[model samples]
Target: MIPFRFLHAADLHLDSRFAGLSQLPQAIRSYLRESTFAALGRLVGVAIEEKVDFVVISGDVYDVSDASLQGQLRFYEALKELGAHGIHVYLIHGNHDPLDGPRLQMELPEHVTVFGAGEPGQAVACRRSDSREVAVISGISYPTAKVTENTALLFNRKPGSTLFHIALLHGNVDGDLQHETYSPCSRKDLIGRGFDYWALGHIHKRSILHENPVIVYPGNIQGRSVKETGPKGCYVVEVNEEGYAQLRFRELDSVRWQVREIPIEGLADEAEWTRAVEQAVEDIREELPQLMSVVRFRLTGRGNVHRILSEKGAAADLLTELQRRETVRAERSEYAGLVWTEGFSVETGLSIDRERLLQEDSFLGEMLRLSRHSGQSAEGLDDLLSAALKPLMENRELRRLLAGAGEEEKLGWLTSAAELGITLLSGVEDEGGAAGPMFSNGAAAARHEREAEE
Candidate 1:
């Protein structure tokens, strides 16, 4: 049996948006953005420490088409460290970093082999002095962003019997909903190619689609945003003489993005809210060690606390205070950093009587009717209205606007306007009295906008 170990990783979206991390102090923001590079260094350090045979980067080394030159250079330096340690590196460009790019001009280390965009693929014969020639490493590159052709067909030609065949690709094996369907292919197509191992990329979550041929996605080396959550890292695979394969996950992420949902049903006061938030933070900090974390705490369920949380500025202030305490704790640790962050958010508002709103055959009822039947243009109006009303509703500004007006006057022109706004935007209803759909999709979008503004 060939005795060898290798690191398989993908989707290092370097220099990407630090959306939630932006709330962090400048020092913390710098650390978070640079964490990907740190994770890359750690990956190399692991390879050197374990004395792995080679390292494979499936794809998406960068985040955007026009990435920073400094970022590219940093990547080159990290890969060069592995090369200096006599570890061979194999790489292929994924959708994010297609082969046809100016950054590819940089000179790479001798031990590193980057698969270019060409006919079929490139193969490297792996031979050791004592043992038999063990494996044939082949890979294809994404010449452009859209690769609809079946690239797996190129690997139909198998390696000699003396060696195992491994193919590294940066395309979607199939149209997985969790990811964008780019460079699509089926499991059978890959299996039929007769390759021993298929190292795939593009999707941010790690998964083993097929074990027989050992098709794997090592996920991203680091989580870039809230969408890509939890532990991010690479895979270490071992193949024995019998062609049986074993895979192990190695977390190389330097920062983590975590989501925690805490129900507000029983929270009676500020003290309860503080206690709940503190407990949640402690739990998350314990779970993730020695890394910066961005946490989104969602308060759910029915309770009196919901009213307090929904009351304009109270919710925002409470969240801010919670984050402040968490940051202090993290700073004292002197190892891991904590950035409790909130972004485009929603808290269930006071529920209203839907039946009563529908019973009144007035302008409010008519507006709801029109909203339900509206087409795309109406949908656009809804979106616009949602953008306008979310802040007003959340801040209780709408309630203030109607203050002092008699019932008839309140339900007159302004009520019609508010109902029209709700119809156009699909927001909380304006029950002929007070109370509506507490929160709506428009509220969510407005929250997002506010977060962005911050």
Candidate 2:
């Protein structure tokens, strides 16, 4: 029934490279390179500031196979600093950094306790102030790259133990499809162990499956790719004298990856469209002021300027301008909003109303009907898209992008294609001449009118 506090963190993934990013700006790339280390430093800073009894890093401390010796040295220095503060650190190696790998052998400070790799291990730490046993932490490290055993089954409960019992584990629970099913175990299996807390890893999204026994996943300290978005951080947990506990999430990432969808339906012209884009960027910047984030925009909706927006160079040009805007701010101010637009896709259609077009007894009406019908029929759209994308499927790059695309994603791609086809056809004149550009004169005319009024 003693009160205690501890920091629970996992998936450090130190020295991991940012994946799926192509041609990022130099500044952003440098930040990505250092983000994992920066985040770990912040976690250590939080633990020291909170003055926690100990820190539990569940797994994936540093990959011995892929990570550099420099990363290993930094990892050790962090634990050494904690040891100097008289704080204990309990760590376990995950699949990415198993014990059997060609890792550096170094002596850690006496305050650091790493669980054994061959089997489930136990380590007890007494409170320095009172010289009484305050916590008993149990965990295991991966002995090989692939550990298929349900390791949670190895844990046993003490009938009337007084100290707080915690289990640190790194594996999938009930076959989590998001990750490799290593050291897999069921939630029921863990619940039966009767531990006071379960600190889990291998899933990069924080989750609390059961609060009764305080089972938690603090997620990775830093996101290493576009697939991993939003804020990434760890948790600080406090257990009161009565045995009840509280969990607090702490945000600790310097950069983030996000996707935003903005509709351009009601935008009158290029000026209005630019304003909308700026507004969205500002909103996201406000939401994540502390982190420098990159966003990929999905511009969707039928509009008068659909052709202008869908031009071959529109998306690239817009992205360049947005990036320039952020760079200007970065140069001018020491502390300003740090957001960059990575790239975008223009998925738009003609302003022609579909219901009205369908009423016409012509090719346009027939085409609209066919597109709608195919979208409604499950197999029709799938077959059409499969045939259209057959040639592209042979390309390794595109194949990677389409690997796990579901029905909805395929349908979305087809819908965008159909919309683009309609827009092109609608703009073609009967005389075989291209229609005049759709860029409106509204902005210039407005300026003229304002000058006249002035």
Candidate 3:
């Protein structure tokens, strides 16, 4: 006979908006929005497949207590499906979904039990067939968004009880700085507390805090940003007759986020750069074969590729080409398994002696020095730029034409002016820096607009 089984999941964070990405195509945006819901559906499927007795969701069921109606409706569908399979769900509210916060208060399925705040809530698990006792589950929810007290100490497990015990909690353990310190507690506070398993939440990265007693964090089911990278899913645990547990992590994210920094030190030209980017996509596809991936790419180091990117309109053209690789299936608007570039950045610098240029006693050198200072200290730069543009803004007719370039725009122009001059001057020195073009009306070049979006 199977000893005992259950699924441990937390930090669902449904309807959580993605960060660091803007102006995504409609189809891609839909994929990102639906990813959390898709993971919940998969979680339900896993419970039915594994034939687990129950599902324990520690906390943060919604991104907010007053979550969107769409998020609640979708979540309802998944739980309804699991209930149909005879699986019971035990849940608690986290900092994001506090008990006192606004909620829809919709009636949940009969098999779903949510623990309340203040005093820890208690429930017992039993076999549906014969009413045989399985385990005792105790948990507490957040009374409000800010829970400073150590709620973990308030649990009651009935000492010397014959049945196994499981503690469902959502809090910061040992004041983990990566997460907000709520319901604070220590490993000492949790251990030796008669819990056979500790189902925990609030920290979005999966961590096995301890074994034997089996304390763990399943992490979030979906990766909402580059910071939450790699495989994210719930843990399927099997407890033997003696109460020892084994864990298996499953990936359910519909879309994955990643950050890749490629060195462009020796890449020769635009063709090589394109090839490198393509390879990166292929590599990520290989790394995560089950889900679609969105990458934030940062091209680094100095190379000929940097010079081409410095040319006007070339970077945008490359981005357009990269986006062209994405394909939406004709039948559905959901994300197909195509690799999407969330954002692209070029940190590669010019291949000239910047230090010597700044130190030189020439007109270009002086300009470089002044521009450098203007870029370094944003405080006084705005005043100088605004003064210079005052003539244009003061003229009644010209103000109507040029007032759009505000203080921020002027600041950007001053910051990039030195690099633009260097690119122009270098172009006149030779054909692709070949040492003999000398004012030969060289090929037109334009500076790249931005270094990074974030």
Candidate 4:
């Protein structure tokens, strides 16, 4: 058996837009716009640096159903660059970029070999130094958008061939409920198949289902959404002369996405929280020092600052300050490797304990008791929320937004409403701007003054 090495990457998603994002600064937007292409470049850089024999890109060559011309040309350039280095590229089409999908008329470099859509295709990867065949690569592309059949069954390895075999597939395995079940196959079926390695794609999270024969998913090349966080890259596999493979993961994404949930329980006021937010960003910056990244913050836990942050525009104002803080860093750097704040949400509860509030023996107490009971039962919560939100549902925007609101989210809104009511009606804020328990201050009534004689 001859020794060889190759880079395994998948889900290029070139020219893909950042999901759930808009209204960005020109510099950040341009970086995001070219993020996938930049990631591809980095993958190629890693491949060259590692001196791999070839690169196997397992499906999803483009983001769109029909390949975009810009993405196609950019991918072609990358292949051409690899060709210049005498490195081969074996790629296949996934549901997103199928073989039958409409694409521009352009020929890829000679070093690039594309597997066919009709049947499982085969290509031999030779050792770079001697040009001796060392590995057999088998793969297939989706003929159309929907490939529900078990396509993995089509693959058949050589009867007694001693060459290393790698299979590239893009589909959902059974019980992989996180992604849509496309070209479904069972783990038993894949493992039973005689292949030295199984490089998978379509699901954006990396996982190694088996190691004996090396079944793995390298995840997407770029983090196009906040949901797809952390380092996104490829696996470099080195097969020693004894026919065992050592795998290494290399992150090639230039732009990363992250979501952080920070608790603000001890933080007292806006000043403390502002410093806290800056520190959080700095910590993240140190962690992802090399890449441009976006972060969304979910501030949680009961605190006095929650009341201050609950005021209208406080969250937005904080976000503005955060952006301003990063803007200076952005101006200093070319790509703004510092963390940029995408969104800041206030999800904290009131400092006063709801259990104690429910025993107050007043209307507020009864309301809190009802809220607690409603949250315990799904049907009760839905009924209470629907009736309470009926008037507001008439507004198209609010109606559209809340239509998809789940039981927990609606319950959060309900809790926030009650907190607002108690905070305002009970006048919990002291003269020193401290928030005491709801109804802790002495009660006062509106004077019944005789209407001034007009």
State the weakest 10-residue window (summed lDDT) of model 3.
445-454
- Model 1, 1-454: lDDT tens per residue? 5756677888887766565344565556667777888888888888887677778888888865547787798888888788787778888988888876557476787888888876556555443234345677888888887787777777654544546778888777766644556777889889888887898988888889998888888898887666677898888877777767788888898788767777766678767976887787778768765777776666554455545564444556766776677556655654374655653244444434444666567776666554444322534444544554566666564644433234344233333454434434444433333343333323533554354322
Let me know the TM-score candidate 2 reaches against the reference structure.
0.78
Model-by-model lDDT, in order? 0.68, 0.77, 0.76, 0.80
User: Which candidate has the top score in TM-score?
Assistant: 4
**1-454: candidate 4 lDDT, tens digit per residue:** 8999999999998987676556677666777888899999899899899999999998988856435788888888888888889999998889888877778877777888999887788988998889999999999999887899999999889677889999999988764644567889977888888998988988888888888788889999998766688889999999998889899999988888887888888887888888898888888888877888788787777777766665544667878888876777666665545788877655665565667777889888888778778888889888998899899987996886677576777777777767665665444564456543321111110110111000
Candidate 4 RMSD computed on C-alpha atoms after optimal superposition onto the true structure: 10.4
Off by over 4 Å in 3: 128-130, 286-290, 309-317, 327-334, 349-454
Sorted by lDDT, highest first, which candidate order results? Answer: 4, 2, 3, 1
The alpha-carbon deviation from the true structure for residue 337 of candidate 4, after best TM-score superposition, in angstroms, is 2.5
Rank order (by TM-score, best first): 4, 2, 1, 3
Highest-scoring model, lDDT: 4
Off by over 4 Å in 2: 327-336, 352-454
RMSD of each: 10.4, 9.1, 11.1, 10.4
Error (Å) of candidate 2 at residue 44 is: 1.1
Off by over 4 Å in 1: 20-23, 125-132, 325-337, 347-433, 436-454
Identify the superior model by TM-score, candidate 2 or candidate 4: 4
lDDT of 3 at 142: 88
Weakest ten-residue segment in model 2 by summed lDDT: 436-445
